[model samples]
Target: MNILITGATSGIGKELALQLTSKGHKVGLMGRRTERLQELKDEIGDIAFIRTLDVTNHEKAEEVYNSLIDEMGGMDVMILNAGIGRIQMLPPWEAESKLIEVNALAFAHGCHFAMDYFRNRESGHIVGMSSMAALLAHHRAAAYTASKHFISNYMKGYRQKAKRMNADITITEIRPGYVWTEMTERAKGMFWVAPVEKAVSQMVTGIEKRKNYVYVTKRWQLLAWVAKLVPEWVWDRL
Candidate 1:
């Protein structure tokens, strides 16, 4: 399969690129760091094709995605994995808004492009990197959590739209709990932090199965159920 992954320079995106390439899939990697992309290409050999650009630059992201899709002989799947989450409040509204831009606006951009491509081809998959934060609100990172909520619902809307249109496409939302990655390296007091490899392994399996939604590390599935059951009073306490 030919795959495209945004934010492929580090963390979950990087792991997905590497693991998928090892499985003989042609992977198109997109990120801002050209040097890191080079390093990944060097490690993965010819299977790795990279386009160095930030997803926030909507025009450039769309341009590079189309070019890379053709470069990879057309993409079978596009992973809308580029996102940002900073544990800060509204005092620094810039940081909070930036989180919304990347997590929601940029995600919408990628999803729209992928949906268009899939609609034309009548076959493809769109995978979104959402978070458990979508299920529940967080105090310190209100914008981040809300942005994820947008992502979760946005993907669901796309899924429903595709179904109604009778389009042969799939939307998979990956909701991960804490994982040990550069994104979480500075986070404090995190629990049940799965190793990056372990998290990616489960993610890949879920993607392969084309599941509508998946919780990383498998154990998070239990938390997901419990999360839905919590009342407002209990949720406020947590």
Candidate 2:
């Protein structure tokens, strides 16, 4: 299958690219880092196409998506994996705006573009990258959590619309907990971090199976469910 993945320069995105390309799937890799994109293209051989585009740039994102769709002869799946997380120590108003811009607005635009394309074709899959933080509010990462919650809920709504229309489209929301990526390396308890390969593997399998929602790690799914059942007062004490 042909797949287009954003934020393919590093972490789960990079691992997914490598794994998918090795399995003989055509991959269109999108990222802000041209150097890393070129390196991945080199490593993956001719089946990999690299696009140096930022998800935050709406016009560039649309152009790149069109070009990738044309290059791949139409995409079977689009993975919305580009995201930024900021642990703000200041007041919520200060950092909240940028967080919404990157994690929420950019993601929403990507989803809109991809969905339009897929709806026209009447067949496609969308995999959205949300976080387990969406299920529980974090003190320093309020904006990040809020943005993820937005995406998660948005995908859920989209799923309902797709079902009603009988569109041959699948939308998967991935909620991952702590991952061992550069962004989360400075986080405490590195030992508990989920391996990038394992997470990507599970994601690929879930996407292939057309699962509606998945937590990259089994433990995270359990935690999210448990968090939902916990009393508000008890959760506040954590």
Q: How does each model score on TM-score?
A: 0.96, 0.94
* Model 2 TM-score (2 dp): 0.94
Local error of candidate 2 at residue 45 (angstroms): 0.9
Residue 34 accuracy (lDDT) in model 1: 98
Candidate 1 wrongly placed segments (more than 4 Å): 87-91
Using TM-score as the measure, which candidate wins? Answer: 1
Please write out the lDDT profile of model 1 over residues 155-237, one tens digit for every residue.
Answer: 99999998976578999999999999998999998999999999999999999999999899788889999989989788787
| Candidate 2 residue pairs in backbone clash | none
Which residue segments of model 2 deviate by more than 4 Å? 87-94, 189-191
> Candidate 1: lDDT over CA atoms?
0.92
Model 2 agreement with the true structure over 1-238: per-residue lDDT tens digits: 9999999999989999999987889999999999999999999998998899978889888998999889988799999999877845756676788779888999999999988888999889999999888887767667888899999998998888888764698999998877888778777654447888888888888888889988878777777778899988986776
Looking at model 2, which ten-residue stretch has the lowest summed lDDT? 185-194
